[model samples]
Target: MPIHGNKMKKVFCYSLIFGILQLIPIRALGWGFKAHRQLNYAAVFTLPPELFKFYKPHINYITEKAVNADKRRYAFADEACRHFLDADHYEKKVPIDTIPNAWNNAVLKYSEDTLLAYGIVPWHLQRVQYQLTKAFAEKNLYLILKLSADLGHYAADLHVPLHSTENYNGQLTEQEGIHSLWESRLYELFEPNYDFFTGRASYLPNVSETIWERFAQSFAALDSVLIFEKLAGLKHPNKYSLQSNGRTNVKVYNEAFCIYYNHLLNGMIERRARASINLIGSLWYTAWVDAGQPDLSNLKEEPLKTENNDETLIQTLFQNSRIIGRKED
Candidate 1:
């Protein structure tokens, strides 16, 4: 497998973990979940499907005080890691004077670390999913917005390559801020023109494959992201910038960054966005299927399952954390 192929695997693992984390209760889980980006319910605007069948007309009817409309207010406790790969110990493994691409030949040197990062992601997602479902069952209802947020979080994670690795930011390669540079910065800058032609319906039979495939494609770009980012840093009109709020004086982006970066991504940005939109929709569809096809028309049942399930996930994690804490003590 290519070096980035390994990293892509890590990103897939994170999605599964995020799904698990959604299982926790809102109170226990806290507001950290918002760190994950919200999914667009606008997808439903394009097609009226199962859940929105009867409720279709009122789909946009602002439900009064049911679910929080502003998702950005809530942040997933574990989500901060999504913006950048955790490489605190790299200073020990790497020399202080090192730049990102310095280790062109060192990709495999940290293979184990890369694999470990990928492994942690899924558990977190699943934990959250458990909580969200239970929470919805409690009120005997599911909030489309909240559910979309959770679903989107996992779906988005699937699309991020660095989420799949220890070198998420390309720190090993000196691409220190590549994670946010690509996921956050690049998207924020180019999202307006991003392609919406993801097409109709999905083809994946298994959820795992869906996750890995998306992640692998993302990971495949790691090299280009890392190497090209460096090139961008060196090429832009004194501003081929990155994760840093673009307004900064970082000359990391220019015609060069655009050229090489796009080449590296192989024109996957718009496609990836489309995939993200569709994946969230598909996941929502699948979740309903797993719930035995809940009647989303009846507001009384949907959000209840979402919230109540979320509460349960929170409780489980607390219990686990307590156990681990006591052991450590």
Candidate 2:
């Protein structure tokens, strides 16, 4: 059963194109890649003097690696789940008290498959916090920097309203692809005016509760995110136009429509970005404090050799299972 060379070549070419397309940042979810990196970079400045010296020197690494988790989604089976929690998918729905904040307890209530089937962001975030704490305890420069960038990413994702809903991209509500539009397109257009000077990072007394509360707030705001977009569309019909987004010219909501939408939502993107900055810094501070506030002045930098390493891993991860939960993309 040997395949012909041409057929094999065609398959390989098609597969390569598909993988490249996935990484092209056309329209996925969760703040897009650029915004995540910017948030991580800014969060470094928010760290106190105690951890600033160590993190500031490696700010570029932290910033670039901030999207590591997003890239990992293609490779790691559970990586996508870590980015979001569609709490509404569970029977109890949002503000769900039935599922424990703890991993084992939650697994007991709803089997491991079930928990993974509906998203496990809060638990995954807690796990990452613990990892960061461990890294701080050991003073492992590599692990500390790696986990800090990673933890910041997950914390930021939790603040995204679309990430917390089953209808993440608004496909279910007939507002399909609204996830990228709200979180990505808006920020790409209006982030220059955002207030990123969100003060110093404070200690979070209860990390799990804080994360859960953030998700709850995000889910609560999901309705407005959708409704306002619908309203804006009605008010400004035929406002979309083809615009050059990188190498492609795609249809996008025009500047006027986007401004109208942003006004209608009372600056949701700015608020969420600010919230992400604060939360990322606070969580990093919390992990460091919980680990005895280790002095990292002497920590050395360990930059990743290949930025495209995750892409290779993603190609493999995608080959295994592209569908994690309710939505395929």
Q: What lDDT does model 2 reach? A: 0.79
Q: Name the regions of candidate 2 deviating beyond 4 angstroms.
A: 1-28, 91-94, 245-248, 300-329
lDDT of each: 0.45, 0.79
Residue-level error in angstroms, candidate 1, position 240: 4.9
Over 4 Å off in model 1, which ranges? 1-39, 45-48, 53-119, 126-139, 142-145, 202-204, 233-237, 240-256, 301-329
| Model 1: number of backbone collisions | 97
Q: Residue 326 of candidate 2: its Cα lDDT?
A: 40
Residue-level lDDT of model 1, residues 225-267, one tens digit each, is 5666666666563554444434454434444466566666665
* 1-329 per-residue lDDT for model 2 (tens digits): 77689778757754674456444433234787779999999898888887787788789889988877875665555666777777777733456676688799889888998877778888889999999999999998888878998998988888898877778877777887687778777889889989998899999999989988888888888889989989999999876899885788988778888889999999888888988998999999999999998888776655654435654765675564343334434
Best by lDDT: 2
- Return the TM-score for candidate 1, rounded to 2 decimals: 0.55
